[model samples]
Target: MSKQASAAIWLWLAVAVFVLDIATKQLAEMLLVYAQPVEILPVLNFTLLYNPGAAFSFLADQSGWQRWFFTAIKLAVSIMLIVWITRLPRTLLWLPAALALILGGALGNLFDRVLFGHVIDFISVHWQNAYFPAFNLADSAISIGAVMMVVDVIRETWHDWRQRR
Candidate 1:
């Protein structure tokens, strides 16, 4: 088997995400009370909530089994993302960063899920009566990374098309 080049440089960003996520969640837990929203801006609020399910509180109403189920899935996915990051080529730089961010975010929440049976979410946004689900730094990093990957895909597609012309 040939030796593979690792995309380890971007792993620091992942660590940062994990650390920040944990710290912020801890602060949110300590500072905010249940069901109370602290307005930070016109559209932003810090509202502490414990989600027992996946993104957007999916399966949150399940009969308590979803906690362990989600934990297992998060572990599997986080491992897979780490493997994917290491396998990524240097030229596809954004791919590794994106995968690493997703991995870190997943692990951050996985830590909570395994220990507390829930993920702490504090950030909230709303417009009039329309409200978005509260999320944390991990979720934000994952989302930004995903968008970066999408942009990378579009850039590559355009480059390939130009080359083929």
Candidate 2:
């Protein structure tokens, strides 16, 4: 594809996300006490944590294999997203941006998994006696990206339906 037409141009977003995620994680590590909640609001806190497994601590109770298992998955997914982004049309905005976010988030967590054998999570949200799973900026990026993908699909489907009428 021509340089001007390559969707790879969106990769700058991925790099931005990665750098921001790493920087925030480092700050959290340096400033927050592990497993202790530093209240930011009535429903939000910064609680440093190390998640040794996938989202929601899946496979967390396992011996030690989950570390490398998740690492491999993250690495593979990052590569696939990069390739997909490259193949997309530059004119397509949302899809490429979403892919870049996911790619960046995956690499961010993969960095932690490879170096620390765990992913650092700090942001915490709770209400009364209930608590949501703690997550980091990387997770936020991935979730937002996934939501964007769903929104794009819905929009496209709606457009197609309208054209058939």
Candidate 3:
């Protein structure tokens, strides 16, 4: 396949993830109140929240500098991830999927940070009185992508080991 076609297949997946993330954020905005959570399950809740900093509220107390910094970082990382995706053969299923997911999620939050100066987060998980940080679909995508990357690495290592043996 042509490079464009190859990129297209993966990029389309990224676009889908990006679009879905935005749509879900919009739905959360309309259906939920900011920081006021509605329980969707015993351990999960839908809540609208914004994060001005990096993951886990890192540097949130900074004097408005973190937003641009993070936006730049995400853009740089996104470019690298896209390049990684395009370089991979489509025969490598999980690797490309993982990279596309990370790229899509990065762009999704990049849009929010650039346009709105923060990310819209809604999904919340908790146990009893303990609460995990609220996150959105973009975050979920990124997390899953990271996990898939680990799986790919493990698989590759195992294959190499077997070949050597």
lDDT winner: 2
Error of 3 at 117 (Å): 0.6
Using all chains and alpha carbons, the TM-scores for the candidates as numbered come to 0.93, 0.97, 0.94
Per-residue lDDT of candidate 2, residues 70-92 (tens digit): 99899999999998999998899
lDDT of each: 0.88, 0.94, 0.89
Q: Which pairs of residues collide in candidate 2? A: none
Distance from true location, Cα of 40 in model 2, Å? 0.4
Query: Which residue pairs collide, candidate 1?
Result: none
Worst 10 residues of 3 by lDDT: 1-10
Between which residue pairs do clashes occur in model 3?
none
lDDT rank, highest first? 2, 3, 1
Candidate 1 residue-wise lDDT, 1-165, digit = tens: 136667867778788899999999999989999779999998999999999989999999998999999988988998788777767665557788888888789889998999899999999999977899999999998898889889889999999999999
| Per-residue lDDT of candidate 3, residues 32-123 (tens digit) | 88888898899999989999998878887889899999999999999898777777666667889888898899999999999999999999
